[model samples]
Each structure stands twice: as structure tokens, then as C-alpha cells.
Target: MSADSMRVRRSFSRVWPVALLAGPGLAWAQVSPPAGEAAAPAAESSASAGSADEPVASSPSAPYLRTQIGMVLETRPTYLGSPNRETKLRPVLGLQYGRFRLSSSRASLVESSGGGGQLSGASVDLSPRGPWSLNAALRIDHGRGAGDDPLLAGLPEVRQTVRGRVSARYAITPSWSAGASLSTDLLGRKGGTLGALDVGWSTMLTPAWRWTLGGGLGLADATYMRSYHGISPEVAAATSRTAYVPGAGMHGVGVSTGLTWNVSPAWRLGATGAFGRLTGPAVDSPLTQARNNWSVSVGAVWVKDWRD
Candidate 1:
């Protein structure tokens, strides 16, 4: 192998065993470097007017690390539409080389929502990624567990499974874009699918600071709705709520915002917030303890470009 290839392999070897966004078992939000944080703008080029808020590019074989290693504060429902809320603190980490990225944050391709979520996964572009891009990812969903709450303790378990996603994004302008994503259970776990459409806008407040806003509409299938929302007669008897059968439709809508700062050449800082609400059958389901959801994350990254 060439020296560059050897160096790339060695870099990955060092980080492979140290789980972060790309790590194993721990399904924090998937990411290499926080996907929520757009990289600082590079020199104005021929594509500059069309590709707003895109990350800096490295050679396909070059090794690089883009990570936000700090605590993330997120407040979300204990379960999908559960009324119960839990605030969690997790560390953020991301590793990238070429067009590939590995992250623990589920906040994947759909930018208009809070996060696309699941676990660390590898992503590759299907077409040349630029103002228009098509990408695919394979990740593991740790699945929902039996909860301590009496309301959720009796529901059918959401089993761990492998998931696949295909997403496409089109830049409408330098500061605005639109995208769609679909996720499905590859393991045939009866885990249905989730799909979303979103529009995003970003602007550079200063040479070192940027801000973004986005909105999304979500949809799910009957199996998905039934798995999470439909309560069985036995579960109804145990939870003291009427059993429900849900037909899939509009899942909900969401809005999100983020800020990223180029603190230095080697460091970047970012913060993001999102809000969502359950709609259609989800709101009427007994298992949905809460109809609204929200979360926030903040962190900083130390970057190293092997080619640099």
C-alpha cells in the first residue's frame, strides 16, 4: 500500500476500538463530527454560490477527524409519544475520511427535524455529492426497551434490528436546501418504516459564525403506527386503557435551529434545538403519553486533517 493508504489505515486502527459516534454497542446519536454543526466556509469557489453550509472536502483517501467531544443535553420523551420526559447527557464524537462519516447521533440526512436517530452507521454517496446528492446508510437500531413506567411497561418490545436509509438532498440556493429521507427495518422485525421531508436555510452571520433553520413533515406506515401506538387487549387490561388500532398517516411536523462557530482552525463549537409534536393516530393512541417533544445539544470539536 502507498504511504497515504498506510497512514489512513493506522489512523482508523487507533480510533476503531475507541467507540464514539462510530463505536459499537453504545447507540448515542450517530455522527462523525456533529452533523448538526456545519463546517466553516472555505474559500469562495465556482460552487460557492450554490452550495451553502456544506462541509469542507478532503481527498477521498485522506484521513481526518471531526468531532465534538463534550457533553450533550437532550430532553426527550421516554418513548415515542410518551408523556414522560427524560433529559440525557451524552458525549459527542464523529470520525470522517473521504465522503464517509461515522457518528453516534441519529441526526442523519433529514436536517429539518431534530435528528434522524438510531446508532452509529457508515454512509456513502451514491452519486457525486455536491449541490445535489443521494446517499445511503446502514445502522443498528437498539430498539425501545420495557420501561419502568406503568404506562409503557406492558407494551410490546421494540427489538434491536439493522436499518437502512436512502436520502437525497438538493440545494435550492446557497443558503437554502430541501431533502427527503426514508428508513426501514432491514431485519424483518415488523419494525415498519419512517420517512420525512424537510427544507433548510442557513446563513453566515460573520466569517466565523453561522445559523440554520429548518422544518419537516414526517410519515409512517401502518405497521409502524401499530407497533408503537396500537395497544393489545392484554396490554389494555394491564395498563387500564382501551386497546387501539392505528392506521398510518401523517406522523407529525417539526422545526429545528442550530448555531455553529469556527472557534479556530482546529476547533468548532455548536448548539442545536428542536421541537416536534405527534399528530394523527399517534396523538389518539393510549400509549402516547405526550404529544410534543423537544431536545437540545451543545459541544465542541477538535479536528485533525492527516493530509495537513
Candidate 2:
């Protein structure tokens, strides 16, 4: 063969291998597998990608298990009318687990005329499902000086009071709710039992602010006339002969209003005022009529949320 012919044969041989090598990729680009087979790998890849994103969904569950704790301080310079005047400093602590919350408050009141001391209480609030919620609390209040009567002399005293309240609220609008509460108080010597029924309207004025107004009527029956002014032995002796006095059974109406502002995600401030008037056989008595009173208080509250 001539040299040119030999070179042409070598070039042809090189071109044939290159063509063979490119055939598979070109065919792959132009042709597709059967619909079922082709779709499967794509579906699998998509699923694997989705699985990688699955962990992001678990983020929401973190709030449920997270614990929220807070401390609060409150001061009430004077409540009602007591000669000594009053100041109360209360420290509050709370823990929330899911929809259940457990809390306690310790109150110390100082009276210039009479020495001041402490009162403490614990409460549990639970909301299992829906808009319904329940709350129960037990409180013990201890202080010396005048009891409930402004006219009476101070008495050395120890008293235990337990209170339970249950309420049902239904949302009337995005910003308003209507609710009612049944509350009972059991007082232990110088002790009495009081039952109250209250209906209220609550409104959310802003995202972090709310207001409530409520009114109720209640009955209080006492075993003895426990006066803030200690009953002199003479007065007790005079009343002792009478087994039960019709004047001791009293019924009254009460009204309350409160405002709460959420200062931040975890801090809140609230002010509340309440007034009551007695209207019954007991009200005619000088002592009972004088005891009709009103009280005002301002407090700071803190709340935290936990979810699971």
C-alpha cells in the first residue's frame, strides 16, 4: 500500500473507536426506559429527599417538653380598711408541663400597727382538650390584728382557708369570651363557708392585653361572730346564750374588674378591684353593715408555655 493510503486507514480506525465510545451516551439521552421502571427511581429519589427533611417536623414537639418557670412579686399597700394599714409582698413560682400548670405563691404582709407575717397557697390549672379549663387552689392566710371588722380589737389568731373554683368559658368572638365560675370557700373556726356564682365577660384589647368584668352573689354562714375587734369576754358571754343568731346568715353581691397586660412573652402585669354590699337580715345589724367593704390590688404575673 502507498503511504497516503496507510495513513487514511489509520485515521478511519481511530474514528470508528470514537464513534463506538460515544454511542452509549447518545442513545441514553435519546431513549427512555419503560414508564414503570423509569418512574420508580425518580419517585425513590424524591422520597429519599423528603426523608432528609423529616427531622424538621420534629421541631414543633420541642415546646411541649420544654419547662417554663417564672418568679413574681406583688405589693398591696392597703386592702379594705385596717388601722395598721397593710403591705403585702408575694413571691410566685410556676411550672408548666404541656396543658397542665402547677404554681404557688408566698405572701408576706407588714402592718405598722400590728406585726405582719406570711400567707401561702398552691394551685393547679389543667386544660385537657377544647376550650374547657379547670383550676383548683388551696390557700392559708395568717396575720394578727383586726380580723374582718374595723371596729373590733385585734385578736391573736390562726386561720386556715381552702378555696376551690371552677369556670367554663366559651369563645364569643376572636377577641372576646363569656364565662361563669362556681367558687366555694371553707374556713376553718373563726371559720365559715361561703359559696359564690359569678358570670363574666373577657375581652382581648390587644395581642398582649386583656380585661375582665364580673359580678356575683354569694351567701356566707358563720358559726361565730369573728370580729376584727376582738370580742371582749363580756360581749361573748352576752351572745353565748343564743345558740344561733339569724343575723349571722348573710348574703351579698359583689362586682370585680381586672386588667392584664402581657409585658413580654414571659412577664405580665395586672390590677384588680372588687366591691361588695350586704343585703340581708344580717345587713341590718350594725356589725354586718359596717363590714360591707371593697378591696383593690395590683399584681405582676408571669406566664410561660410548654408543648410536647
Candidate 1 structure quality by residue, lDDT tens digits, 85-149: 66666665545554555654533221211112212455554545456666676666666666634
Best by lDDT: 1
All-Cα superposition RMSD per candidate: 7.7, 29.9
Q: Name the regions of candidate 2 deviating beyond 4 angstroms.
A: 1-87, 104-120, 125-132, 141-150, 154-158, 161-190, 224-235, 238-250, 285-292, 302-308
lDDT of each: 0.55, 0.34
Q: Residue pairs in steric clash, candidate 2?
A: 63-307, 64-307, 64-308, 147-228, 152-229, 153-229, 153-230
Give me the overall lDDT of model 2: 0.34
